[model samples]
Target: MITSEKIKIYAHYYGDSDMWARRAKSSEKAILSNDWYLIGSLIQEIELVNKGLASEKFTLNLKKHLIESCDNQETIRQLESLLAMNK
Candidate 1:
């Protein structure tokens, strides 16, 4: 999917829990529940319905997606910085 479409999907999932979504949006680190797995193995790895662990690989994949779909410049900069370190 294109980044824009993925962003919409992300927003839709987050929008389900209105209050929790607002809080998650405001927080730097948020563990959200959604069946939005970009990495297939994550499905097997996670015991919870939609919760994913913050493994190095998972984190990298997420950041890459956000960098593609996120509009926030600061957030992209932060993600890229972190990505550089991982590489």
Candidate 2:
């Protein structure tokens, strides 16, 4: 749904449902396999791909959602620690 009103699911390539589905599955697989680097790269792509105001806001909220999704305190702390250390 690439339009002026609706923010695209993904900003790269084709922003369609199928691509979004693949991204979700791939991210899930990466998580299941402890492929942190791959998932990190994927997330980084979100930030990189979004350039518009709406897209930027969506990506920001997406990042917030990801952080909020972590229920474990230690995991959250580790994520925060890693983010803090990021150059």
Candidate 3:
């Protein structure tokens, strides 16, 4: 089970984006089933569709969650390393 703290953090990362939050919040159960790949896909969709649009703070918070919830060390490292290339 995903911790409540993580969920809260994710929700904060989502902020006031109702559509994105709704989609992600609805899929919360499926996301915790060790299906990190699907979660990654969902994240990518959110990033692409909402890219260059979210506030800097929200984007950074979202990126933090992505790094924290990534399936493995490599994925976490990869995402964190990309912070420097934020567009």
- For lDDT, the strongest prediction is 3
Winner on TM-score (2 vs 3) = 3
Candidate ranking (lDDT, best to worst): 3, 2, 1
**Pairs with backbone N, CA or C atoms under 3 Å apart (clashes), candidate 1:** none
Q: For residues 2-83, write the lDDT of model 3, one tens digit per residue.
A: 2443334344444324434556565553544354333445456346536576777877776666556665555554433333
- Identify the runs in model 2 with alpha carbons over 4 angstroms from their true place: 1-32, 38-56, 67-69
Q: Which stretches of candidate 3 lie over 4 Å from their true place?
A: 1-50, 71-73, 76-87
Scored by lDDT, model 2 comes in at 0.40
lDDT of 2 by residue, 1-72 (tens): 012111112333133335455665554433333333433443454445443435667677756655554444
Residue 4, candidate 3: alpha-carbon lDDT: 40
Q: Over the stretch 1-87, how does candidate 1's per-residue lDDT look in tens digits?
A: 223333343444442345444554532213323323431222233222224546767667665655554557564443233322222
Weakest ten-residue segment in model 2 by summed lDDT: 1-10
Taking all chains together, each candidate's TM-score versus the true structure is: 0.28, 0.29, 0.34
RMSD of each: 11.4, 12.9, 11.0
